[model samples]
Target: MALQILLQLIVTGLAWGSVYALIALGFVLIFKATDIFNFAQPELMMLGAYLSFTLITALKLPFLPAFLVTLVLMTVISSLLEMMVIRPLVGEPVLAVIMVTLGLANVIRGMTGLIWGYEELQFPKPFSAQPIMLFGAAINQAEIFTILATALLLVVFFIFFKYSRAGLSMRATAEDTSTAFLMGINVKRVFTASWAIASVVATIAGVLLATFTYLEPIMGHAGLKALPALILGGMDSVVGAILGGLIIGVAENLAGFYLEQYLGGGINEITAYVIVLIVMMVRPYGLFGTKEIERV
Candidate 1:
């Protein structure tokens, strides 16, 4: 109830929210471009974390170098999947695409287990260990960096999708793939670009998350946590993803903190779903989702 405690909680929420937003953004980007709910995204995130960890720990690479390498590698992998597997499946049944992505997720997860082994590993502490104080609340340097990095990425994405040619093509394709193709937008290329962008964001999210939680092949389940955010924000709205993520993140922190005293513990695990249920009751199409209309 103290003002400082509330501030500290909010800072924590923002950090976690940034992570969720990045993860959810990946989902929204892919779905917007391809209408494919990439169930493999979580696994891709896990792969990002593992690859970065390996580069830094095993190869003795510097943090910046390793992070950059991981980003490029993951982008290539995601782009390849889109070009090889997803591109070929275009115009197929929606369920089939969903199932294939889910299968690919499992395949990635299994591969990660074989390579990384089934253990929780720590990412190297590359950020400063010192905690910065703001308004009588202490925040870790890593947390500060995470917030800044997330914000910077969001801004860059806003500019990209707003001003860049590729971003415009993505928007056009999302609006109407056939129309975009007719206009010479290269819809297939848009799909591949979206996946590459999603992979980059997921890798960034994964690296940040590894700083907070122990990294394991199963850690990719973090995507499940972001799904409700994706729904709450509007599956097709990128900005909605950002808003939804913050709301869910803050709600989880506040509810977990206060409710733990009453629920015995771990209520945060279901907070996103609870929020989703409540939000859907009020706005079935989600806060920013487009509603369909039909004339009979």
Candidate 2:
């Protein structure tokens, strides 16, 4: 019984962690490319899930088509947001940009509530409902699919960043926007593309989350949970985001499974924040972030 419970917790943690990681990746991606900390990522995820629900449930669109349409819509919205709001704020202080993101997050949350109402809504599963057996342990098919999908997306993203021309431009812009511009790269376009990609990732994460838990307005707050992963993985490291996410997910699950019995209440949610605090205190630059020296 003990072993079984432990395995169950591990599986649950990985599943939830992957979702958190996906959210964190959005933050990391935008931050890496544009140095903007987008607090609206979770809301973007919420928007994606709601959009999916609307297309499938209300508009009566087919599942695959709805999913594709949601992706395209999210990409467009992200690009527009960058061009309209974020672009104007270029060269602003980090705090200023972050504040804008925070405000945008709230705006999105409110709009989502207004459009979809406050009630929790279910999203249809894109995979089998049955749990799959793995090495004597049973895991939900949806969870497995989520993990696989995230991994695949991450790999595809990695390849794009490594080899694609647009990806190269993004990396150039990220390293030094002024230099990238001097080198003929369109820095503004890169920023817009970064946000668009982040939006797409957020949408996929939201959809997967809705598969596991019912969709709600507050679901965008999942971005808060992913913050620790961003910090741990380093603000500029994509792979670091993945690693940070897995760590947070595993730690939260273990904490909830082992410590919750003694401490009581929901420790998993609190665990990520605690981890972030500890990481910031110890390694301020994060695990993979470049060290910066402050002059006076």
Candidate 3:
């Protein structure tokens, strides 16, 4: 019984963690590109999910078509936001930019509630809710799809960042924007591209989460939940986001199961933060993050 429950938790946690990893990836990408820790990412996740729901449920579109369209729409929105809001604020103080992101988050949140209503709604289930038997453990079908899709995106990004010209441009810009511009790269375009990429990732994560849980404006909270994953994985590492997400997910599940029995409920909610504190104490650079050397 114990072993079975443990396996169940692991599978479930991985699915949930994939969502966290994807959202965290958005945070990392934006931060790498612009050095801004976007607090609006989770709201973007919520917005993405709502967008999917609008395309499928309201517009009566097929799942695949809705999904594709949502990605495109998110990409456009993200780019436009970068051009209008982010670009204008370029060279501004970091604190001022952060305030913009925070304000943007609230604006997105209010817009979501205003458009979709404050009520919770059921999201379209793209996959069957059946559980498949794997090594005598029943794994959720949606979860299987979730992890597979996440892995596929990760692979795509790996190849993209490694081999593509635009990828090189992004890396160069991330390393040093002025230098990249000096080398003839369009730094503004790169920032827009980064936001578009993050938006697509957010759309996928939002869909996965909508599948995992019900749809609601409140679902955007998952974005905020991803911060700990970024901290755990290193704020700038892509693979670190995935690793941190899985670790946080599994730890949260385990804590909820075992620790809850002793500490009551809600330990899962705080488990990732706890891990962040403990891990930082031992490795301030995070599990996969590069430590910065500052000179006086």
- TM for every model, in the order presented, reads 0.97, 0.95, 0.97
| Candidate 2 residue lDDT tens string, 1-296 | 67877787787788778988999889988998988889899999999999998999888998789989999999999899999999889889989999999999999999999988999887887777788877677878888878888889989988999999999999989888889989999887888999999999999999988988888999877777788888898888887788888888888999987998898969877998898889889999888877889999
Mark the regions of model 3 whose C-alpha exceeds 4 Å error after superposition: none
> Weakest 10 consecutive residues, lDDT, candidate 1?
1-10
Clashing pairs in 1: none
Query: Could you tell me the TM-score of candidate 3?
Result: 0.97
In model 3, which range of ten residues has the least summed lDDT?
216-225
> Candidate 1 lDDT, tens digit per residue, 1-296?
37877887777887888888889999999999889999998888889999999999999999999999999999899999999988889889999999999999999999999998997888898876777888887777777778889999999998998999988888999999889988899777889999999999999999988886678999888788789988999888888998998888888988888789998788999999999999999988789998767889
- What order do you get sorting by TM-score, best first? 3, 1, 2
Summed over model 1, clashes come to 0
Error at 57, model 1, angstroms: 0.8
Q: Pull out the clashing pairs in model 2.
A: none
For residue 278, what is the lDDT in candidate 3? 97
Candidate 1 residue runs with Cα over 4 Å from true position: none
Candidate 3 per-residue C-alpha lDDT over 31-66 given as tens digits, one digit per residue, 9 for 90 to 100 = 999999788888888898899899999899999999
